[model samples]
Target chain A: MMTLAHTKYIVLAALIFCLTPIFSQAEGLIADQKFKADNEIFVTFSGAVDRAVAENIANYTVFEEPDPDIQLELESATLSEDSTRVSLRFKEPLNTAMTHVVSIRGLAGIDKTTFTVSKSYLGYLFGILISALLINNFVFTKYLGLCVFFGTSKKKETAKGMGVVFTLVMVVSALMSWFFYNFILIPYDLNFLQIVVFIGLVSLTVQAVDTVLRKVNPILFNSFGVFLVLVIANCVIIAVPLILANNNYNVFETFMLALGAGGGFLLALYLMSSVSERMQLAKIPPTFKGLPIAFIVAGQFAMAFLGFSGLQIF
Target chain B: MANDKSSMQLITRGILSENPIFKLALSMCPAVGISTTVMNGIMLGIAVLFVQVFSSVTISLFKNLIHPRIRIPTYTLTIATWVTVIDLVLAAYMPEAYAKMGIFVKLIVAFAIITMRLEMFACKESVNDSFWDGLGMGLGFMVGMVVIGFVRELLGSGMILGYDVLGFKPLLFFILPSAGFFVVGLMMAFFNWIEVYYKRSKGLK
Candidate 1:
């Protein structure tokens, strides 16, 4: 017969596993609506915190509307048994359409971040897509891909082609490299070999693509030509794995980043090329005829994108 | 006697005629990023100078051993190894300088000029020729960095090498990327005009 203690441990482990997904879906201690119950205030955190952290009492603060002008009375502050939910019962139940803020500080998840949405993985990935694509665009804001940004941006058609190639190559290669990094290099304590490995991976991938395309899509490959070959040395191609590793982005986020970065790169490239094409007609000085003029234009673009810095989407 | 004269020409070429930044337009990425401060520019330039010289000489030494098909990858690996060494040594011995130029040092591996030199001059020439060429290119790169850095630093913060040049700073925009572009543009124009005027004076095309 199975021991009673053994059965209890198994049950607890299963419960934790099931609750983990739902709990981990929160960004932070989001003020959630208390299931149609009157006067009860519920604040749901994303993941299970150390119960000890919740017990600290000082880490939780509740403020009633008006932005720091008033403070709400907490009648009973109860941490859920699983430490995933915190109930901050107001002195009186919320009856009117009122606004309040629940400030949580210094609370870490059981083993991860409070912002990782573990259950609605798709939605989370979408946010990352938008974030990387627009908010922190690789070229405009982050300043990666400067070489290709200027190199192929002279003409609109070439820029578009380069953008498309960059997106496809970066997206596919980033996934493979990310998997290799997290699974192998990281475990073996050989992360110091990142530059060598990352460059090697990219070169190998572009080569594989070349051979595969030659075999399967000879016509398309021939049409595209040497563009794919040039990607091996593009700074951003190598920078992808480095950035992903530095941020320790989850798999979904990595995928989103690759897509978003590539998309942003394409968008920036297209925009830059059009702007420069117009600039060609402007009577620029002979000295500033080429790259110098382009740099100035790039600076203007950087300033325009800086406006996106104040966004609070994350 | 002819070899000495040719080596002299090689070193001078980078400083003026074949200047990497103003003329050839190589390694523009780091040129803009590090030129924000004069000290940063000089430090990064010196680091590049070292790597460019060593890598060029090494590539020249092993030119025969490297296969044509795999030369690009071989050159990259060589540059990358030297860069890593420079990066670590800087971090250990010159923490203060490394603190600022640390990221820039690693970035040297990807510098187009270093590899361009390897392909254009190093593999094609003897080790002795490669050394002078590397020095010229390295000096040219350093000069470009320092000049851009000087203008940016002096104008942006009213400082040069950490010494304040102006009473109160003006044209603060020079420090910004927008201003960086303009400075580089104006400088390019200035350099080009000088080159044109010099060539015309000498009655050469």
Candidate 2:
């Protein structure tokens, strides 16, 4: 046998070599914590429901209460069986203590089921995007941003111009909101001041844009004259920040939401313009000249979008 | 020359004769927005009322003081300052309502109602005349919002002031932006229809 000192040295070396993997494992733990902090809890229906039924359930916020801190990621329903199996995934980790009941209201063959949460960040992100774009759309569901929509939709040329302007404005506003919310508002514990801050920013941005446009290109400025001014207080500017805060999206996901909202705004404006142009040639009744006919057309369009509510592409 | 109306008559015209969204079709932005619920409509109406009355009074009072070249900017700044104050107050004490009202509160600065009233009436009238014009126009706007809100909340959500009223199932479509368009359109048509019926009955050729 070797001397005791020699054996001790060998034992120490062995311990170091064995403990290397454990020390390296600390990095993984950090990643897990980061993931847990960022990840949202989403639940996907696994079986026994059709895709349409599941989608309707997702859009139904009637029974589901609103939670400012918790973001609900309504995923598209996937059907595995003969229209029997349905599943949903949450955007964040589900609270094991709280049970989520998916109520299948008025579906003949569908059964009401409860879903368990699984830890998947990818699933949650996808579900959040779907929910944002379709199920609980800011523009469509809430009627939050109609001023821009109507103002832009009056003319096709103006609508395209407004679309470009809106996208640019949304991106800039979102970045400002993210920084303000994370750094200033949250740190100072002045969350109540969000509305004031966001509104001030929007007003300033609009005034700045107006000044620059008027100075640089009088022709373009005149073309956009009234609309440019009108867009300053447009709901999209203020609402996006509130939504980002409510949903608690990270930088990347926040960008996606901003993009989706901008796109949705453009979509509504474009659709309205096209419909209004068509109505111009059609003989609308005298009483429904300007706004009355527009409302009826909008109602029909809303009904059409309801079909997309059931799509679970994500 | 005989058709020229007095200041009071002109002010009344702004209320009913030249109603912005309904009759004159001037300011569609605020009318279409904030009409989703009674609370939102009322809050917006109050804000608009305050801004319109004050802006009209101030602009009328200082109409000659403002340089013609920069009058628009001066008026905008004045309106913007008041809007900022209102925004802060709502955010502080009425957080929930503020959240619900969203950007429309800020949009008051750009709302053609205040600016239009300033340009059309206040800039050309006495302070007293401008005040009445603002009040009448503001009330008209409030009426429009309330009417739209009543129809939308009643049909779309089947509830009023968060209380169940009609017992009819909520049509989710009505609460959406598309439904706003529909409701406003129908209301406008309905108003026109009534106007036509009354005109015909009174034989006002």
Candidate 3:
């Protein structure tokens, strides 16, 4: 039982077990950092570090990037159980919009890092809304749904009606598709069929809207009925669901995207219709009279819309 | 001989007389959205070509089996299937191009051009004729995309296929989304003018 080979094996096993902790905690660099809250930051080191140096409040400084002279006071520095992460709490909340920096002195391998506090939920939603509506307006910027955009935009009345119907269809279909994608398709591993599924959903949504509108209010249906069917083929309606799915957006975010896109389409249609209604009078060239001229005018609108790029809503 | 001549005419009609982008004004979205570079235009062009031809032939062969009441949905199903095939092939073979194209590839199902051709020509024609028609229309679309890409790249970036020929950008505006509309509109007007002149000369003859 106490042979020399067996003793050698036991000694090797014991040595390996004893060396794992030291090997695991060999590196001393900061591994990761998170801007957890306005008044708190969590910095994780690659390995176990010196606790005395990490917990010292005097060694840490936090300040906005623009002004480095006025440093925020650190209330406390606490080390985690593993001694690899340190939480730095400040006396005051950092500004959300400003770029912030955190520096640690007397730490050998920790480098300074910059971060910004996460946007609030409402702020994030507002950003998506304004982004879709103005910044990345589907009609002018992305060149989506131009078929209906140009078709119904000849007259303001028709444009407004079509816009309303299109918006209603877009929001409903987008939400329905999002539900199907997240709940049914993803669980079943059927993402490849999203195109077929989304198109089918859009068609069904349009048909349902058509029937319900006719029964609920015949007069309103008569005015809006023609554009309801066309909503099935509109790329904007399809694009919204695909985008939401691609980005893994939740229900409210999907709603906001759909609403913003629909609103942007409506605004573009109304504006184009207003100008085209007047454009019927001022055209001089024969070849460039109808659609060609309309395109050039739309190009100008696109140019103007480009100015909305990088606009901060929140 | 007559069938051959008609086939030739069918192919040529889509390119010159009834071009999808310029003449029919269908599928304007992709023409502007993806034609920023020559390579992008060609890739989408080839993808659409395959989808168009395959869908056309399938719908033509199965036109009788599909019910008239629900033909639109059936046609959409066929197109979506072909598009899915292309989408997968591209994703597997060319990840970089697929990344650039993004959702537009999936949105091919909503492309008015494919469905319009299926409804207008494929359903009514023989399988052979439908193939020719699809090939012609697809080629016409490809040609249109290449030309737009050429102009945009040449003027916008002063380069062609990543080659810096001009050494300096010309307008720099042609690459913008607005310039896509402008170029397309101007080209449409130019074609209109040429058509008018051709008609006037023929009347005199």
Candidate 4:
């Protein structure tokens, strides 16, 4: 009897030991770190963190990964109403180029978890580039530039030319819009005028580029110059500036985004043109031969591109 | 009586023969992008209609003044101005409505159909004719959008206008972005087949 009772107690203890991790995992605090801006970090805990511990600035230590000696001065830590999230504001902008580490010192059950901001500036820019190029392609995913895309993509040579010209035009026009938006539009309290101003700016840029390209390099202009006018009022060109302005991206971020978008457009145009060149021979019903088939083909491509979604590339 | 007959024909033409989405196929971007739900289609359709009509009238009123060499830019500016005015007016007068539909108004600037109508119909026609053309084109586009949305929403979500109808999603693919192209493509083909069959029955080419 003594041996049997001892064996039963041992079995109970072993079961409890096996289930301890599961219980802790369900109850323990999990911190999700997100960079809201250069100077703001939002940390969301899995469970409600204690109000005093979360609000205490001393409980947190933030520093750039490369330079741990210089601790960032946490100006204020604002806890959300439910105590699940906390907003930590710093005196200076955290160096986005480097990974940032935030360590919670005295939370009750959390063992001084040092949560690191996952993506650095380069990583963030890369994310944007990949996202624009593959995940959320302007042409395939967002459905911009379809008119120009369909019009010019019938032939590979024209498609290639249009793609290069489009990238150049997009990059230049996006930069100009950025300069105008930051220097002119914001300072004068003319936010309401962005649509009109962006349209005017795009038209001016295209015209100016047309003239300058024709004068500077006639051969280059002749190859793709005809497409310059068509670029104006193109949704893709207009969307980049509007997006950058809305997100308040800085100069470098804007440049990267424009490059990615332009590159993505070019990639899409090239792929579609290649497929269409081969599709010239495919037999089909008369009704599905032209634009209808093109759309269906595009739908197939869109389905293929959908595989790239939810990919983490950092 | 002749003027009245022509006016009626002009308006009805946009609705039937020259329907923007089905017949002309000018603005496929919004038709494919924003026609995921019936409400979205209606809202965007109304915004496009407002901008299209106003810009057409404004351009038609001043077509003679615009230089032929720079008319494209002028047309674009006119469209942009109308879009801005609509945005501002809605934001000021109807804050709640603006919050829902304001973004659609701004996107009107880039829609090809608006500028296409301005160049082809409005600039060449008189103000009264331009108004009718805009209304017809707008209504046609709205009808096209509603049809696409109705089909997509029905198949995609098993619901219509947020109400569960089918009890389960039929074809989940219809809700995805890729399905937009397929739906539009199939719809276009269907329309083409109908036109051909109708012509055959009427003893016309």
Which candidate number maximizes DockQ?
A: 3
The prediction achieving the highest TM-score against the true structure is 3
In model 3, the runs with Cα more than 4 Å from the true position are: A1-116, B1-5, B202-205
How far does residue B66 in candidate 3 sit from its true spot (Å)?
1.0
For residues A128-183, what per-residue lDDT tens digits would candidate 3 score against the true structure? 88989998999999999877777888999998998899989989999999999999
With candidate 1 superimposed using the best TM-score fit, by how many Å does residue A278's alpha carbon deviate from the native? 2.4
What is the Cα-based lDDT of residue A198 in candidate 1?
69
In model 3, pairs of residues that clash are none
Between which residue pairs do clashes occur in model 1? A23-A46, A26-A46, A39-A93
User: Which sections of candidate 1 miss by over 4 Å?
Assistant: A1-128, B1-5, B99-103, B199-205
User: Candidate 1 lDDT, tens digit per residue, A266-312?
Assistant: 89999999998999789987767777778778878877876776343
Candidate 2 chain A: worst 10 consecutive residues by lDDT?
A: A28-37
Q: What is each predicted model's overall lDDT from 0 to 1?
A: 0.75, 0.66, 0.86, 0.84
Q: Candidate 2: global Cα-lDDT?
A: 0.66
> What CAPRI grade goes to candidate 4?
acceptable
Residue-wise lDDT of candidate 2 within A38-82, one digit each (tens)? 223323232333456545645432112234344456544344445
What fraction of the true interface does each of the listed models get right, in terms of native contacts kept? 0.40, 0.51, 0.75, 0.70
Q: Is candidate 1 or candidate 3 better by lDDT?
A: 3
When only the first chain is scored, the TM-scores of the models are 0.66, 0.59, 0.67, 0.67
The positional error of residue B50 in candidate 1, measured at the CA in angstroms, is 2.5
- Model 2, B1-205: lDDT tens per residue? 1224666775577667887668766556556655778777788888887888888999989988988877776677777667777878788999999988776776676576677778877888888788888888887787778778887888888989789998885687667666666777777788899999999999985
